[model samples]
Target: MVDVEFRVVSDRRDGLLLALGQTVIAAGFTLLRQRMVNSEEGVVLTMVVRGPENGLLLLEERLGTHHLVNSFEASPVDASVANAVSAPAAAAPAPAPAARSNGGAPKPASDDAATAMDTRRVEALLPQLARDYPNIFIQLLALEHDLPPAQREATLRYVGQRVGTWVYKRDFSLGGHLALADAVRHIALPAMRQLVQAELQDDTLRIKNSPFCHRGEHGSSCHFLRGMLGGLLGGPHGTEGLRVVESHCRNTGAEACCFEFHA
Candidate 1:
């Protein structure tokens, strides 16, 4: 078992809660219970979690995102008395700088130029591209066309899963299972700029009208969206049982991109 206490500086509880969930996922634990105790200075969040191997290390990595947390503490609980606070405190060591894979040798100028362009265009232009340009779609196409077929598909799916984790971590405090489903529905259309029709039955989720399907082609697409759904539902939140499948796609002459998510 693991117990964590976070001292939040601000009452903006939403972000802090989300950050806590992110940290919990990073620590490779399932949050069993959480309590918020109001104090004179600020709110103190106490979390009880199912422990993982190297849980302290995971928590330390995730704490970097807890900007609102003024102070934090964690301790592994003894199995005999899981609630007892007598266990030694886990103090994370200071992180060291990252080293190069090539023994610090300089990379090619052409590689550096490509990397610079990707950073400037992809990172800097993301928000504006989503609003004004079809940059998201363009980038998706570039990913597909710029690499070999297998590598391109694998890259898209991997990116999708990572983005899914990001989305789930940011909005995880929305409450129980039904509420989470509703949260996903509410965020879809506005965020993706496509009409999203969602249906939940048992553990299966069917989603149609994805933004990636707004264009036309000739085969199965929307792999990134599939990855996003997989990551959001399964990643970080202990819902890895969920799986995503794009059964229909506009690229395949379907009316829209239809994704079926099930265990």
Candidate 2:
């Protein structure tokens, strides 16, 4: 399924949201899902595609008529989403750096807010999941850190069955130790997003549902959540006019843990 995504760069995202709701409803397009995020850039709209090419065309046409979207750009669904059904979305491309017309730096608060949310976005989504399947969620994190390689693989191979369509991304390349982050991209995330939308999700972080949550017990044997959890854990860019981020945060670096299903 193709997703129509809109990202608003201006401070007045409320205007963007208004324009979006009107356009989608007037056009009779299904509002499959939407998330208003406080991103590193600014307020963002992560919208799931729920209609056809014609629906998108009509929606775009309507948005063009609105002053709110005059400067905002609408891009195709995430390349990765398409690749899931067809071809792999091309390897990630280098996004252009944010620049100032006067060739100076951006204000501190906005930049810091954006940089900080890179890691927090994942956490923001977690509360809802914790509320619903407290057992499953807690069990997963139980095995998050400090596990032997072979054992970690065995855990994921088992958890993947319960969670469904998961992906493994590792960041051990930089450090000498081996690590794994397994995410239930297709299964767990979609369900979670639905719960979030309905305001029905939970906020627990313990994995009481699965026994795997108790791997070394002292050390979280559960990297299933840790597998794809690497991206939000690294250093940031240090160029002039750039924002400073925590040393371990990879949000500004190329060392992303992974992007899987957000259920």
**Which numbered prediction scores highest in TM-score against the true structure?**
1
lDDT of 1 by residue, 208-238 (tens): 5454544333478676777667665653353
Per-model RMSD to reference:
18.4, 20.0
Give me the runs in candidate 1 sitting further than 4 Å from their true place: 1-135, 173-218
- Alpha-carbon local distance difference test for all models: 0.49, 0.36
Model 1 RMSD, rounded to 1 decimal: 18.4
Candidate 1 has its poorest 10 consecutive residues by lDDT at 91-100
Model 2 residue 160 lDDT score? 28
In terms of lDDT, which candidate is strongest?
1
> What TM-score does prediction 1 earn?
0.40
221-255: candidate 2 lDDT, tens digit per residue: 33343332222221121112311111211222222
